[model samples]
Target: MNAASPKPVLEMRGIAKSFPGVKALEGVDLTLYPGQVTALIGENGAGKSTLVKILTGVYQPDGGTIVLDGTPVLFPTAEAAMDAGVSAIHQETVLFDELSVVENIFVGHQLTNRFGLLDWPAMRARTRAIMANIDPDIDPDTRLKDLGIARKHLVAIARALSVEATKIVIMDEPTAALSYKEVEDLYEIVERLKGQGKAILFISHKFEEIFRIADRYTVFRDGKPVGDGLVAEADTNKLISMMVGRTVEHIFPKIEVAPGGTVLEVQGLSHPTEFADISFSLRKGEILGFYGLVGAGRSEVMQALFGVTHPSAGTIRIEGKTIQPRTPIQAIDAGIVYVPEERGRQGAVTALPIFQNITLPSLARISRHGFLDLAKEFEITRHYAARLDLRASNLSQDVGTLSGGNQQKVVIGKWLATEPKVIILDEPTKGIDVGSKSAVHGFMSELASQGLSVIMVSSELPEILGMADRIVVMREGRIAGTFDRSAVDAEELVRHATGNTAKEAA
Candidate 1:
């Protein structure tokens, strides 16, 4: 506890919000002290996003009292909230690809000249100053599209820091897409923000992150505040029980399935820049895991296998047949399907109804000629939705309306409807809550037991260790090592991924 942080910089009391037929938040309370990181722990649909939306003024609360530095206030709009020194860096980094770094930072509140014109020089100088505080090497004039994912997050952080009187900064699942080293870098950035005396509210599903950076914790469950305490006094099981309203005994739930013959094989798969000479075999009824650090070509290899990217020098074979898939349709026809990590953008169409999203890839099966079969659509939708435990009002509900975890379920269900022989899940449980993760893991085991080949690419060590029958560790665009469940541990995976021997003196 900091001596200076005697009181909370921000407080929410009896906060309530509701949608048309659902109460998103109910009498929720949260307290954030200056210079201290408060981790908001919860399962998806725990009213965490609702509370955040209310705080950011995206949704005017149905009823609540927001006390800022002991003075009650209301934010009529998002800009109003930001102007009042509340800034948030979301997981997706709401930014424009065409805009420059400086432009993104000073988007709405641009520095203007005396003549009321856009002040480029002043904005650049200010952007430079802000970027220097975060990362000096980021060019202020670079287009947002030119930078990688981690750097984009950095720019978003810098934008948040640019708030003239930043009293509170909110980070929502900020490390979802980041790798090992990049995540460590983000931790350093967070520490720097803490040093600057900013009240931080970090939202994450990963308990490791909460224990690593947060001083205090606030747990939410089913639209209400369930518990609040110091992070040092909590453990994973305690937090999980509070978040899910039950003890999640089996987080992984990987069932032992005997492997069959090779269903899919990638021989000498090569991408000019992303990866090289990637050779692996996925057997029927086996869960093969791909583990790697950022830029280690994990996702790229999956993309190539799914025919999203062209493999310059590779041979793809399915069940003894050498089939070259140059497109996703071809891959699907060959009984291969991909469920991407970015479920928001790549996996699911948020605007579409759950039934529509699920039936999109397999329209032929559910459609007669060019006419869509409504009954068939609902039949397929309900089946997979139930299989994945997708929580929604109905199949007609927009996928976007669901929580992040449910959205992931919809994506997984959509791909499962295709009835592919082999499935490639890229960070399948990336931002999913613990309860939802268990369901997905159980489903993976069930699929493997049914003789469906599975390739799971994940950054979480526990997930790989728990679910994978075999693991192929990648380092610098190549296979570092391949190991069985009995042969590899967490330390061994990290060592291979990082090329560190980690030799210890006895």
Candidate 2:
């Protein structure tokens, strides 16, 4: 609603899309004005991605009209959309590893000279110019794989800008994997784009990021537009209500319990390059929270404790028994289970049936004389599935077909079958919907109440403050501070996590 903003460069009206069993989008509308960032926000399955796909020509809307610059248009293919001045930079980079940075920026539309041959020099110069506009120091001739994740993202944005006629650019969850500094860099680049008179569609679940860069706001829920307005006029609570259709009463659902004896203890744990001298203790029926920024080594320490990585120097004791686990199977055998952050890759086998995924870790216990017991597997799967309130057509359905929250439940269910004494969850509710997050949090509380010690590794401050009985903040591979739940303060936790100040507590 900025009066200085130009008219809308692109508009979608009455967009509706559906599959056999799903209505992905229903009559959703959006307008993108030049020199403004319009944030598209919603839960995991709230049709944000569906709308992006429609605009990028990934899926044709069953019903809708797309207008650009006072003219109606239909993009039958992704290439057609780009040629018509609409480009999208997805969450995952689409660059080839073998290609150089210059080649990646102009891969699809290469430059040609008068002789009709590939003009490598011209492309390299153009790539350099684009890189200068963003980072100035990124080498255009470097291979794509040599750059870090942040630089790779920069290349993606530069690629979008390389299009001569690009008027609208869609960035979908661009900062999901970025570090704090990387996120700042992205915000700077977004501002530069806005200055260039380009309309940007910024899709993100992080409200902080939305407030940082977005000028306009739109909220979607269950495939329909629920709210749309200027960012200046909206607050986080208002946006949350719009996204979930109700006020989320208890996001964390933490339950108070008297701490019992120590279930797991780590002393002087060290990894060569990841973490150093990390130590913590988890009591029975307690939720221990590990808080840090991305790459602060929280996940690395969890990975080491879970046997995904070995510590160079450390002692791990479970229930007062010293043990060293060399592999994940060893950790599982010792009654320690991990729910990894990347659920799709490390947690569940998407192509496998839901029952199979749940029972995969505990197959040894359910089998008879080395032969699989199908009935036992089904029974165990049903027990945990029902406990977690997992939703699916049937237990035989592929795990890939479920939503993000359900898939996370399936991962947790698989580990719960082991009946581990201690469970480590890395970013447990990440990328899940609000309702699903509440369910997951409630399940964690239930697990703790049942005398299971939980170690939750998360970058979200609210989750740490809300759910933790004892919070440990990490900074650059070391324990910076620790505080009891009753003494928790957001500013203090953030200060420790970012190394602004260290206040180690008893």
Candidate 3:
């Protein structure tokens, strides 16, 4: 530590929290110094969210002390925490889309005139001033919905700054959905915030972002603090070990398999505004990777192939037979299935039971002569559920109640029940813990070994590099490049995906 460096502005010691049948946190400690960014990292169930909630006053710690500037304090509510100069911008922006940017910035604490009327002019001017520090182009009078995701995030930060006394800012996964340039813009804003002497608590799963922005690091595992130190002293392997409690030897467990004849072939696939002239072929037992940036039309192409969206012009061939599917059911019937990107919304029916979700795609096969077969349903569900190592209270347990990893397994199991020839997985490991991600990777390898053709669409380059035999890079609705796994590196793949090197790499 530097001799002239400031002391921590906030200190959390011996924090403990629990819910029924689960101890979310135990004896956790975090220290945030002024003008520094501290990253809080862990696997999905590792108590990071619980600790953040406690810090934000959404949950009072079961045991511990929060010391601010050498004095113990308690924040009984979210407003109390904010009043005490702590504010958080969550993963999802919590702003009213119907309201204007100015109204959102000063929602609950609007400035009023001496006559107790809303001070519209003062609010607008103040909003503009605050936004200028982040992005000068944003209009205070525009509706929140009119702005893009990155601007909405700026508005959230502007709302935080509007507090006037916000000494500490908690940004939770702020760049999860942002484009590359938007992420760079946010990094600039963070630097400005630090320059203004605000302590920052940054939470993110992406190690690249953490290494880029954080000065200090604190890692959690199994509800307790395992390590804390300067980011300069930590490497990716060390951080992954701290989070997962073991050396993860391989994150992508891809198994080599001799591919058979083409199972699915697409020719001239086009979706008006989404994508165009997409063509690819998936061989039996092969893993084909789709690599791209956030809006490079990767997911759109996969969705079209699964019949979620009709292609304006295309030809789809399964085996040697030409087929055109107008709906998901028709795609499934033709031996094609898709596990969607937003698993919570499109992959599984959260309200339904685990077994029900698993057997959802194969209901007709499990049903008897125009009648439902409960026994057959349970049998089919249990089979794939075991294959995927799905952990839940029971098959009857609500899928919504399971952890993200388990829920994802249920989604995969649901589709596997169909016994499809081609499976398209869009961002399969997104928002999942490392252990779960390893398990999912193992399962993918197993499926390929069993002669199932897989198409993985991912923005994460490491995932694509580690698992794919061949990668197709997309840029702005078109295939920019194609590469063999042995011949291309991440830099080359990224260059192709960003159109920096538009020609095929190999």
Candidate 4:
């Protein structure tokens, strides 16, 4: 377990890649040895992803070489990379929606019985065996679409393991969508793989996760390898400073502000299958925080309020106007906007241009005589883009190509363009880096300062504590408890969220 070791199982020397103006990676060198987990830590635009793409054959390095198993190898495609015993499980789980878990696991290479037809029994047996090794609870016969995001990810990992991969396994934010219990399960699996002599390249934004799992660590800053050494010898402050090249005084900046009168109210909100009897209120200049375990119906409550899902029973009022929004368009018109938890799915359309995404919802406002006013559109888009400090190829660049933080900015910009009185944010900082998360928090504070009511749903405890003026805890679809800023502690919130305590009414 020492840093000074024999030849690594996989090595990248002087890897460099570039776009038209962005020098994505500049002579970054990484080594992954058998039986060690190497964590690649960096901010959003740092060269971590660039290096991974190069190693996975999604992109060819403009410079440097890759050596696997003591031999130089050139991967022409992703299949070629996998053929050479390297596989990457991305932050976004990519699996066939229409196929069963077993089929997804053995999609490319299926076992045949006698006649060379698709062999279902053999595939099911192997899939079950693989899942038993990693995660046995996932049903092999279930369709991929029916599984939760975390379960789908486990299936992806099982797919990679079914191929008998041995050299290197790269997991990019694999636990981002997982619950606390699921995260522990994933760590256990990682340990098992490490015990089997598999080299793992772990890319994540969570510092605690790296400290717990990583054997060695590398920090990338502005397209260069800024730090590389043993993880045990590194500290959080040092690692964060190296990643962003600055000292972060505080990760969550909570500003003091007075809460105004309630601007939106919900009484006995209930959904047949998702949640029930959830009651809360949001005041102007106040942030209502929702804290609960994943799938505790927090996001579902927000979705029901925003008309994404119909509630079986409930009432919602904005600014003293009782209304049940039948659609998201109506919700927006009613001065309510929802930023969904799945930013990549419900936030922005990646294939659209960044500016187009920013102005997509408010196109009618910028239109004149049934024609789009390009000048006004660009003006509004640039204003928010600059305000958010979004980095992209250009305003016209596809939203998909931008970093995760920038993509999230586009989503926020799109909603802001509507000029809503009430904004609902769900896990707004889920996958973003620390710098971007701070920017988003600042924006939220700024919006609230402008007398806009915000209801934020978050899973991270620190974020809920720092940003919210009032806190709401949900457990199994009901309001477990509510706390004002001065009345709550982390342990108390968790206790109520898990239904361990019933707090008296505020």
1-506 per-residue lDDT for model 4 (tens digits): 77577679988999989998789998889999888999998889897888888888889999998988889999989889988888778888578999999988887667887897889988888898888866788889999999877688788888877777547899998888887777888898889988988999999888889999999998899999998889999999999899889987777766667878888999988888889888888888888899888778998888888888999887999889999988999899999999887888789999999888999999899999999999999999999998888887689999888889888899998999899989999989888888888888988888888888888898888899989998998888778889986888898988887777866679
TM-score order of candidates, best first? 1, 4, 2, 3
For every model shown, the clashing-pair count is 0, 0, 0, 0
| 10 residues in a row with least lDDT, candidate 3 | 1-10
For all the candidates, what are their Cα RMSDs to the real structure?
Answer: 1.5, 3.1, 3.1, 2.6
What would the C-alpha RMSD of candidate 3 be, to one decimal place? 3.1
- Whole-model Cα lDDT per candidate? 0.90, 0.89, 0.88, 0.87
Model 2, residue 154: C-alpha shift (Å): 4.2
Give lDDT tens digits, candidate 2, residues 1-506. 45565778999999999988889899999999998999998887888888888898888999989999989999898898999999888876578878899989998899999999999999989988888867788888899999865678788888988998999999987876667777787888888889889899998767788899999999999999998989998998899899988888898897888889999999999999999998889999999999988878988898887899999998999999998999999899888999998788889999999999999989899899999999999999899989999988899989988878899999999999999999999999876767788889999999999899999988777888888899999999999988997897998888887777756676
| Candidate 1: stretches off by over 4 Å | 2-5, 502-506
Give the clash total for candidate 2.
0
Candidate 1, residue 369: the lDDT equals: 75
Instruction: Give the C-alpha lDDT of model 2.
Output: 0.89
Model 2 residue runs over 4 Å out of place are 1-5, 94-104, 112-118, 132-138, 141-155, 502-506
What tens digits encode model 3's per-residue C-alpha lDDT throughout 77-174? 98889888998887755789999999999997899999999999999999989888777899998999998655787788788889888889999888
